[model samples]
Target: MRLRRLFLLLLCGLRAEIQEQDVRAMVGSDVRLGCTYPEGGSFDLNDLFVYWQIPVPGKPNTNSVVTYHLPENSSAGHSDSHYRDRAWLSPDRMRQGDFSLQLRNVTPQDEQKFNCLVFRKSLELKKILEVVVTLHVAANYSMPVVSGPSQDEELTFTCKSVNGYPRPNVYWINKTDNSLLDEALQNSTVSLNARGLYDVVSVLRVRRSPSVNVGCCIENVLLHQNLTSGQPEMFAGDKRSVTDGPAHDTLEAGNKPVFSVLGVLVVAVAVAAGWLCRHRCPHRSHAELV
Candidate 1:
């Protein structure tokens, strides 16, 4: 039984099959799909032809990304319009068994399977090799920017993250309590740009608390990466004084001059009453007169 299973496994290995590879690429960046010939076997360019293929959505036919004919020593045809002028093969390394494809200015739509095939023909025999790579594209968004205004007893904060793909999750944090802001206090929106990337914004409104620090956080759930804005503080109450004066002047204004005048008048009246009593008394004890 073991021998039969081993033979089946070996036979399957010899047949053409899909080999998947996961690749992460940022939007507007370049990426390379590496495809090399079978190990321990090499073929001369004179007898080889290589091509790359990708599937088109809602279509039965596969799109030709690029192709090279060794006999002609040139590209056999132009790539699809979407990939034209942006896809190419490494001719310098072709003879060394490397059939890698380089793609430039990639976008979200470029996330798909890339297939590479090589056919070698000789006078007595023909051989074929196939490789398939699955690419996973991702976009990195800019740092979150938080802004807003405080009015009366309410404070509002807005958070924005731009140019990211696959949609991002955005929320607010109250650093004073080490907790995420309640959903009831926040609202968020997302929009796709012309390039198919996402622009996310969130707004948070709550009663003003000057002691708490509020911040915005943006996350790429697919990539498991996150970015947060710097801590922003809130302020409460009407800090402005009535008079347009310096801080010290405002402090001095709180003191009333009428109170100071009244204090002096009370002391003078007490002295006058004591002097009249000393002069008006008809009889007095010796100690008292002295």
Candidate 2:
């Protein structure tokens, strides 16, 4: 009987030693908070109440806000108003040693130290979790400069962007009517010329009525800020002229007076040729020939 009692004592001591809790996180634009507790503990989660609280900065020993709580089935408990829709408990997977808390639409206000409180029967145990969320804001992206010849000429545009975190996607925005024209003029090319920098060159064959406006937009997926520019500076070959607008002159419709003068000259020449043929003809009538 004494040996059995000693075995029971050893088992209880081992269980107590194994009851461990800790919090870990992966830091970045989106931060994750993790919580883990040893299994085979004396506490029953169903009989226990769980709560999360964040302490106010500069206010030591004072809890600023209650973020979340798991109320008893019979109690008409309520979640903190601020975290009503933002906080959620881990699923069954978490009960099996997975203590991950998913917070959606994370903001700067949510960055703080958090604590997880566990209450079972009349015993209370608490664990602290540190959460640090970094905000990544992308700067504005610049528009491209289109250059080259006018109608029936080769054209090129260079897209540029600056001050973007976590890199930016660069591409040419195209606008064409026909499918063939779209395929021929489409500039889906992209390249990262430098760190956090990008450039794309869009090239196409210029046709009649050659002027066109192209847009370059830089979008930040995390912040959802879009910056777009369509006014591209025109250039003639590798050199940029001091000219104040499109390199080519706008052509007007209809024929000029020069075309009319050329037509009149051709008519006058035809009449003179007919008169010369008549004068060269001899008097070769049928009676004269006999």
State which candidate has the highest TM-score.
1
Q: Model 2: runs farther than 4 Å from truth?
A: 1-32, 38-43, 74-79, 91-94, 122-290
Evaluate candidate 1 by giving its C-alpha RMSD to the native, one decimal.
24.5
Score residue 236 of candidate 2 by CA lDDT: 34
- Taking all chains together, the TM-score of candidate 2 against the true structure is 0.33
Off by over 4 Å in 1: 1-15, 60-73, 123-127, 150-154, 233-290
lDDT per residue for candidate 2 within 116-213, as digits (tens), equals 44434343322322222232333333433344333234454434444344344433343231112232443545465444333344454434344454
lDDT, candidates in the order shown: 0.62, 0.39
Q: Candidate 1 — worst ten consecutive residues by lDDT sum?
A: 244-253
1-290, model 1: which lDDT tens digit per residue?
Answer: 83344223323433455456677788888999888765635557767656677887788653545544444565544457777787788765667788888889988888888877666546322335677878778887776666543465567767777888778877676645445666677899999998889988788777755344666667776666666665433333333222211111011212432334466666764564334223322212211000
Which candidate wins on lDDT? Answer: 1
